[model samples]
Target: MKNYLNSTMIKITLMIVLCMSAFAFNDSKVSAKDEAIDLRAKAAILIDADSGKILYEKNANKAYGIASMSKMMTEYILLDKIKAGEISWDDQYNVSKYAYKISHDTELSNVALREDGVYSVKELYEAMAIYSANAATIALTEVMAGSEKNFLPLMNKKAEELGLKNYTFYNATGLNNKQLKGMQPKGTPEDGENEMPAKYVAKLAYQLVKEHPDMLETASINKKAFAKGTDDEIMMTNWNYMVKGGIYEYKGVDGLKTGSTDFAGQCVTITAKQGDLRVIAVVMDAKEENGDSTYKARFDAAKTLLDYGFNNFKMQEVMPAGYTFKNNKTIAVKDGQKKEVAIEASKAISFIANKNTTYKPKLVLDKKEITAPVKKGTVVGHVEIQGDGYGYIMPVKDQATVVTTDDVQSKGWFVKALGGIGDFFANVGHSIF
Candidate 1:
């Protein structure tokens, strides 16, 4: 557990901050070549969850019709409320007249809410996530926040906090009735109202999966009904067809959500884990020339990126903070120091490599030398490692403890107390001589 915590890590982790410090070194821009996949979406983004690296993207930062992916924010706000004990999973939720009416009025997805039956907050999350049950989302949003009016504010605030510069929220179910001007149920966009839009709904979806991985256990289930012993009778189904059953070798495909609207076409956000590496793919507005929504394109894109990551990258846990990371001179105590003192790595560094690339990282210690009565986990030195493909920057620590170099030559704490006695003896000795 001797993990190194570096001062650099404590600072805003500018992934390329170190690289920028010395010279304007341009990274070998990878072309990201892979012709096996085609995306029909107007916008899409494939991201490496850990590094926020864009693996693939069509319009990575353009805002478009997000459709039901907006429910992910709904779920986040709901889950945040639950975690804070503002609501319980089992709290009874009766279908509000507003929720029940959406099933018949809106041209949207729903489980056909039962107005009289009670559902727990947890059941609605599954319906909203796995099934994209629009009614479930609206009801959950209203109940959790007392109204959609208040929840929408939190949604935008949270998006801004996450650095999502291009997202806004108006409704919980993602139906921009605003787009359906002069239509019956699909209301027109209000005179000045706007909707939440993100360049990559997949990025946010991936984040949710990582933050609450336990949600995957619930998300992986393809079908379910409300709590059995309760008064609910309707059954629910998953929307992601591949998650329902697929022809590909999707071994650890665990999460997330699916969405679709006439404008958004077939949208999907997929998350999977292979060992320690995780990839999330978001596809929006997917449709083909044959009038079929390109669900396979989304599926293939996810598998492609996951395969790419798993095939190329491997994680290497660096040496512990106290161990010698390289042959560089270790930081040691200076003033009264004897040989050395304790120094520990204050950070942990992991490296990612391609198949042909080797994982030989170089070391970058903070300063040239150190003197000690140094405390454990103190910042001492650093390590930087690089190969043709992947590289990592880290810190180092002294393996052992040290004391002052010369006891009499110093006036440290203990020495000061004993200095008076030594000075008196010196005077007496001089007189005798």
Candidate 2:
């Protein structure tokens, strides 16, 4: 009995091991089919501008000092105010003594606004966006909300409205927290320096451009004169070197922002478009080269991230609008004049996937059998595209019109008579009511 039991136990163990081995093999195959991206930045993300889908990320949720990139939000709010008629491009604002001092500090990025010098909203914006000028940004902030102190609430409110969860702003200029301490309004405690997860930054960038595409007009301009041709007209150059004619300029690269500080290291938020598709990439705290004064790491990382997105992905049409999936597309119908109803995709859908991949369409019906009396535009099911290392669902398109087929028209005369009687009574009741 002992020998028989031992043999039986060995057999059971062998079967279990075989099953585990098979499952492992299958998991590996699935894993091999997926694509991946790598980044050298401490935190980074690449996302589709339209869908807001994250295509790739590394340490994306880790908070890092975003430095001047915070100006993206400042500019966004500024534009909103301008659109609401609270301010205008031609409206002028006076520079405060504080702004002038910060501009000349030599430690902070500035466009050197003279105390008492007045600049139109447009000119100050050009300086801030193009040069990452802290002083111009602060002046604009003061003008917008009465003072930098009163502006924090508005900025925070906008942040919440935009669905930002991983960030908090200390000042409008993205200045270091220490420099902004005195600027905080009384009763409002310092929240420290501004920081955000790379993903949130990417989301903000996408939202910024989506809501105000014209902002790109400012971002894309690599060179503009702030007081043109005057001795004070400083030729402000965009710090984002990835734009046209910049050192790391990539084809189709346009306006955005660059940032760095002792704490934030080096960072950048970028957007570029090719055809109808646009991509946003954010990189923060990239490793610097020894003795590197130019902050080359952030730019290099941004290039790599953008190239990875443009080169590895292609937008493929899963289904075009008004496409009729008629071939074997009939869906079974219950109690219908017709045995089956034809179906198609309801709308067009496109997905970004690997360049060389192919996708297969799959129809998933809400129910296996669609009851009769279906309308022309009824949503019966959804289409799922498989392959290409990606899969997504879209509403299925069905035939233009479907009603009980004539197959039921010849139903027994008794049934037809009953239907006529019922209609007569329903009409009578309606009239009486």
**Candidate 1 weakest ten by summed lDDT:** 390-399
Q: What stretches of model 2 exceed 4 Å from their correct place? A: 1-38, 185-191, 229-231, 289-294, 320-330, 357-362, 386-433
Tell me the tens digit of each residue's lDDT in model 2 across 363-411.
6667777666566666766766665341111112321222222232133
- Indicate the worst ten consecutive residues by lDDT in candidate 2: 390-399
For lDDT, the strongest prediction is: 2
Supply the global lDDT for candidate 2.
Answer: 0.75
The TM-score between candidate 2 and the true structure equals: 0.77
lDDT of 1 by residue, 1-433 (tens): 2234575564556666765764554533333433234555666666556655454556666777677778877887777777799988888788777777775454567776676756778877888877788778877877877666666778877776555656655576777655323221222245322333334476567567656767778777777875555554556666665563544437667667777666666677777777777767777666665657766755655565567667755555534433444454344445433444433344455544444443343555555545444444555444454442311111122122221222222338677558678889999999999
lDDT of each: 0.60, 0.75
Residue 396, model 2, lDDT:
28
